[model samples]
Target: MSGESAPRATVGSESLERAFGGTAACNACGARVAEYRVVALFLHETAAIRAYCARCYPAAADGDYHAGGDGLRLDYAAFAARFGAPGPPPPPTTPVDRMLAALVADPALRLLAPGSEAVARRRRRVPYPVRVGFALDGATSEARMSVAPDGRMTDLAGDPAACDRVRALLAGI
Candidate 1:
């Protein structure tokens, strides 16, 4: 690991559990993690932070150093503006947040807001599908995708091309 130390206001295990319950998902691999390290990334005129499980931290750090993992490349200023200094770095958003943000940004996809019956129904399925809300000209009016436990988009109810696009977006995250 690099010589860098943890950021200020870094929360301990008790705070983490209070903020995110017993399990928090790894920001990179989407695995449910009970233990993790939080790092604030400063790069290319941007700053943002994330919590990474042991397995994915190395790769995420490597990617940050190498300027890989493009898309909404977390400008530090923007992050600071959105989440001002104070308490623990805003807990990394859940995998669902990442997924919804990606889907909403794509013009070809019309993201569904949570709490709808459609979204709730899909969430009930075995293995659970990430209810995408909707996609324009998609295979189904109600868009939902099944994601592997690892966070990969395994299948989607939409045009193959749109699905591919969504998958690519998710992969970048």
Candidate 2:
């Protein structure tokens, strides 16, 4: 989850834009904003996008990166202590693998940082059922996917919006 474009998105209350914008809730502040200063979308975590307003912009993650004039400093040792190894090992090869990878690679799905390593292990049976079953297991969430006989309907165990996003991702593949 590192690229852009979520198919359906919006900016702020100013206007109703299209193509991967964001929601109304401010990540820093619970109130709905008049205009979204920033939107953050994470894969496999929340279904909706995160909206940040101008009032809370300085308190968001971008602010942490911007380094405000508070004289706060995180040296190398502190950084190392704060963050250990990045994540679990990458998922092994499987029939349903790389779908998420494709989503991550797509420049159109500017998803936030990926939190865990997930594998798409195929649930197999004889004759290759049209209703394919697979699971994507990550460090935090485990998502299950199944296709209908016609290959139209899909069932995802996690967030509905996330399920829709995954369905869209799989559709593109």
Per-candidate TM equals 0.35, 0.23
lDDT of each: 0.43, 0.33
Indicate the TM-score of model 1.
0.35
lDDT per residue, candidate 2, 10-80, as tens digits? 33333222112343555444555455554322223211223455675543333111111111122222322
Name the lDDT of candidate 1: 0.43
Which stretches in model 1 have alpha-carbon errors above 4 Å? 1-89, 113-126, 133-143, 148-150
TM-score between candidate 2 and the true structure: 0.23
Tell me how far the alpha carbon of residue 99 in candidate 1 is from the true structure, in angstroms, after superposition. 2.2
lDDT of 1 by residue, 1-173 (tens): 11121234333322311234455566545576777644444322333345567786664444321111121334433544544533334444445445544554454443332312223234465344554433445343344576543445565776566566666777776
